[model samples]
Target: MKSDHSIPGTEEAPELSYRILSDTSSSAPVIVFFTSAVVWLLVGTVFGLIASFKFNFPDWLGNIPALTFGRVRPAHLNSVIYGWASLGIAGLYVWLTARLCQTEVHWRRLLYISAILWNAGVLYGVVSILGGHSQGIEWLEFPKGAQTLIAMASVLLSLSILRTFYGRRVKHIYVSLWYILASVIWFPILYVIANLPFYSGVTQAAVNWWYAHNILTVWVTPAGLAAAYYFIPKVIGRPIHSYYLSLLGFWSFALFYNWNGIHHLIGGPLPTWLISVSIVASVLMFIPVITVAINHHLTMVGHFGKLRYSPTLRFVVFGAMCYTAVSFQGSIQALRSFNEITHFTHYTVGHAHLGLYAFFTMSIFGAIYYIMPRLTKWEWPYPVLIKFHFWLVALGITLYVISMTVGGFIQGLYMNDPSRPFMDSVQVTKPYLMARSIAGVVILIGHLFFIYLFYLMIKRKGVKRLTPPWYEKAEEYAR
Candidate 1:
């Protein structure tokens, strides 16, 4: 595919010139964020595998405090969420904001500082969690000092991004920018409020869920969605199927997602109206989900064949489809009846992976696959390895989610039946837990391949590409 970076109908010389300038300006900070994110991805994967295996071999590491399931599981979560996902998103924000804005990134030095502080915060928080210094809140388990560092890093990063956005030369902002802009603005406020020391008791629980859910909505989800919006059409060489639909999707998502988190508190001691409103918002999520699905799907209806050659398109389209599936599943999950069955079960675990790993992580993977080459000006060294990485993670997540959902449903059924002993629930989930462990192993192998490929690309060990890798013959479709 031709590397056309101009807006449709606005493919002027200045736009093309600015695209090159933007890439050059954003390259260093982008690479730093991605490199840090990959390191964390490896760390998180190891932690996750340990956590998964402990279910089947509970005593294997039972003697080690840091290796125990409690510490390992949360460590896995924080590593991936704060470290891998957040860092990757930061890199994408730097690149995408510059590209969309038609300007070089601003305050480049601050972005480098932000990267350092972010990594330091994650490192300190992970150590503190393993050392039993956890704050005990779900997502905010990071100690106060660690949270402060992350919050400060986020502010610095936001300053750079907002400054770039302000300096944009474009007459019209793109859809991706809207999400990027919203996320940077929303996250620091959410992070700071959630980390405040005063919340306790039931109020703490409420704030915990609020922050847990909103972090995904306002931070990660927007970045993931922005990637899908940008990469899908960019790779396919077409504009999005519907710009108005994209706006509708964005606004509705912003309106409904914040409220949907309270649905996690359905069975808790929260106020009836609070839970009721959350349920309503969750159900209303269908509006945005459907609109996004239509926009992405219709955009790719005829370009499915491109997935054969473009690793970026394959991962992104997979992620976009999963975004639809997971969002719909989330809407169903918020209902009182479904939540009753799946609330505390491994089904929720399956659901979270479907959204986070399958949707968001894969989207980031696709973005990196596309963005890294442009920044580094190197082709992927091993096409076969890319294929292997894709199938491994794809099949791995499929098995993982299937086993957890099916097993957790049975486990839930057993628990709900008072006639059956609680042990029955535990016993029934063993096989599925084993399946999840196997899946983790597969995904870990994929990450290893990806990390190697990334290293090769960064070191410029690969053959230089004369053109972008389009599946089959390169065909330039109209923007």
Candidate 2:
């Protein structure tokens, strides 16, 4: 009897051959973006560790203005958000758009230029922040010059994506493409509006939070969700359980998420009606969250076992679950009653990490694991290193969130009490802050392992493999 599995480039596998061609078309730009993302991830991790330790040892770097927590914290944030997440998602946008559209990437030169400009912007922004030239807005800390470079890069990148999407050969667009296309349209507009110079005082606060929250909604969340929607089903060899649910999720997310940021201003100088509307929108987010959870869970119904074998499945699924978890937590946090306790406390810090690190970063990690082998035509050097990388970060984030949450809640209680001294709240959080520093160390080590592995794979220094790196035989996986 002949084997049933068709090799990817063989005559019997026209669809697979087309996919190989798409990957080939996307390889160069994707490699550059992914490489830059990893470098930024390492840089951001170091900055984050320093910031975390400052909570426990504020005087350690107090003499060095550049290493002060105020500077280092935003440096860490900009490096991770603009450098790591943006670059990683840009790489994914190129590859996923080509694969889904069944066409070669258009405007390849623009993409290369975009990558260069984006990296330059992030580097400039990080250095400027360290040198105390920040814009001083929470999320928009980058100075105008840095923002300009990033904005220009974003426009070029968006043009390339739109061109590729316009030339698509496929008639029916995938769910992933919906998010990618929407993000491409939404982000540049959001970025341009947020960086406009006129706003000041309370208006600037409103604009700052609006941009901070929408950036995650329009850019990071969509990228993470798109990766989950594609990789989960792709690795498990199944279509999404319900196209209707996916449409519902996407439309509802678009409808509700834009209004969510104002809820952060529940007790601020903003108009009462505005804050109330934001709360309603935040609660309404449950509609999309539940729909997406169902869609992913149904798709994975019989495929849970695959998580043990496929690293892509493992990281993506973990991220998907975290998406549900973090979204629910956020909805709860948006409530005025709940926000009163968690706002300005370490609890918010934990929640931010859950969404950004556990959900978005992990999803991107899974994407890199799946896409790199295809792009480089080389397997990951060591499976053990990958496992260590996953567990160390997982454990680190888990510990970090738990410690901060418990300690923060207690701190919030002390803060609300009139009799207690403010120092009591600060003193109570000391141990948790120490734990956070330890967690940062663990995460930094994990990142080091990941970057080392990435370097080896890029250099093609690993043991040669004729098969994919699934936990089982490639033949079985193919079948």
Candidate 3:
């Protein structure tokens, strides 16, 4: 890691920070986390691009077994979740906890072991999926061995984290820390419960959907949001806009999100009581989502201009807004009438992307942009590329969301019309699928650009000169 500082009457110095965490020592575990995340981001992006493309150009990739839409969709999803999202967040967690707790990572010996086991589980899960070993479960489609391995590794990771938190430097715990703590606490319970066997098909489906949505609400969303709560306010140089709103967001979500998972099955064979309860819970979630949204928006009220200048702020606010949109849409879509129309359509796919990609992934991108400079002790090598990544993904998602929403409506109308053939209804979705595929390409390009830029940031031989991170409208170092 390196640092650059300018004095009023002196030349800038490009001195490297000797520590990885504190610029003291190389932390291979951290590097592994980052490397795995980057590689998988590209991998997942490519598969997703192919899957989206297949909707219109069904034979674009030929009939290759591994490239089929059915296969590619789940494969891409697994890579994105296990390979990119989980690894990055876990890596960040290890560092963040160590820093906050003011202690070296507790299980130094398990560093390589946990990394290997975690990655091995992902590898197995992905390959088994391609081999048609999926359990046909929504999110838990991975092979049994991979699932258990992940559980085992998670246990070890959680232990280390618990021990780390037990030895904290600060007396007052921050909101972000609480989120992280709750996430780890909630995850293992959900993971095991989701993996358990059920007596009936209906019960299994209910449990699977529960595990799937909860992972987002409890695991990925929390990690991403924790980053938001800490980084957004810190970057803006202010405290949270509403402390009450913050607490409201946390408690409301905790109470509602886990229960709302059944909403995904509202039209299915699940008990009427279950679906009814889920719909109410989902709608009630608007309380928490709005609370978080208002907190972020009000905090950035006067700082919207900063989005034009700070890549970190710009992309983060983009994500925060998307979070608002997703939450609102989610609460509404849980209504029975709406679910009847939107279920089993590209519309549902688009909604998930809105929450997972536009909201969570964008926030993580912002976190990386800001945190990497400090963690690696190096500024981004190509700032312009960062801007390209931002706009490409932003525009891509916009098109994706709009097109799918429209197509979903068309799909629902056709489905409701008993006179129409199912294939005819599916045909109506082709244009939307094609649009989403194009969006995927645009996003993929953005990913490749960032991967390259990220590489340069770490390359010791990368351009020796240091420059300020890029922004839409900022002078040399203004952003």
Candidate 4:
């Protein structure tokens, strides 16, 4: 039963490598962050479903102020972005940084405190938004009180990361570490500038887009890409296609994405030159996107078989593919002609989910699948459940994106047609809106199953077996 593959000691290497890569010092903090992130994932899913339904069934929860569309929509956005995505990214980077550096975390206490405060701050922010205390900024809807606490939490977490890097055992920092560090450092600066109350009128609008778009490009994109860079090679037991290409991708992305946000203000009161520059930056994003995509795909070449045996590879590869699709789509969407039609449509919502859920969330899910077993010393209990979770979400998001994208395109066309009545466009969206709601329910089902699976993993109550859950061939060789 020895491996037919060329890599010598393929069976033993994973176990040995995992032992070396796992961070015992930061396990507690990582667990806390992941647990909280899952809790928020559930919360945000429910809120998203409620918001979707309000589109077609306006009276479903109309009686309650907090459940109203205005409130619920923001609640959904904030919960997922801050509560789920942020925490998940934090947990991932901490584990990944420690693993890559070949050292344990330095300021463990700081990470612990930050986890507590970060959750509290997010909870307070969601509550305040529901209570009608929104800051009235798109992504900055959290009240000042909540923003302040979250900002403080971010500072603590950033410092903890720096401290970890300070005591690193690796002689050379890996590419993943670079992305993680940039995200941590960029976040607080972005947060502080975006939340400052001094700007007004058009200036404020510009600042809002700057913050929102940069959060996606600078903060979340790096985290997801870093995980992709690490896990693709790790799972396949191959080096990245080109280390030099990866560096070019990272720095180019950092330089270009900062100016990309102003594209969101196209046709607004902003100066024409500013909007044009943003469009140029958005197009320039293709350089990095293509470079990284090539690097990942080349590394994954000839390892397509691994997807069947490695749940981690499946999810990570799906996310990596989506990253390419979404980024290219984003560049096209940023063009003036394209933006004019889709800017105010549900198309943008689909686009956001493409980036957030398909790319970032899925990558993180794959990461958790790989790391959780390493942490708990038990493999996933049921491959069926993992398969179920994967398909349910994959199908749900597919349906969600198709419906919204087509519906938004129709609505946009209708809006531009002066001959058509405005309400007609609104009516055209009803069916798609319902599809979105149904898609939410489908995704929620998958999420619930995921949480239950995580519970089983934590309690060590899964099926009894000696082999890695996904890679049974390994056990054959080991025996």
The per-model lDDT (C-alpha) reads 0.91, 0.90, 0.77, 0.87
lDDT string, candidate 2, 1-479, tens digits = 12233343344544554565577778889999999999999999999999999988889978999999999999999999999999999999999999998767889999999999999999999999999999899989999999999999999999999999897767799999999999999998999999999999888888888899999998999999999999999999999999999999999999999989887788899888888988999999999999999999999999899988888888899899999999999999999888888877999889899999999999999999999988777789889899999999989988988888888888888888889999999999999999998999999988989999999988988765464333123233332
- Top candidate on lDDT is 1
Q: What pairs collide in candidate 4?
A: none
- Lowest lDDT 10-residue stretch of candidate 4: 1-10
Q: For residue 355, what is the lDDT in candidate 4?
A: 93
Alpha-carbon RMSD, each predicted model: 4.9, 4.6, 6.3, 5.5
* Ranked candidates, highest lDDT first: 1, 2, 4, 3
Better of 1 and 3 by TM-score: 1
lDDT by residue (35-147, candidate 4, tens digit) is 99999999999999989988988989679998889999999999999999999998998898878866567688988889888999999999999999998889999988889
Residue-level lDDT for 46 in candidate 1: 98
As a whole number from 0 to 100, the lDDT of residue 206 in candidate 2 is 85
Residue 317, candidate 3: alpha-carbon lDDT? 81
Clashing pairs in 2: none
Model 1 C-alpha lDDT per residue in residues 352-442, reported as the tens digit of each score = 9999999999999999999997787778998999999999999999999999999999998898999999999999999999999999999
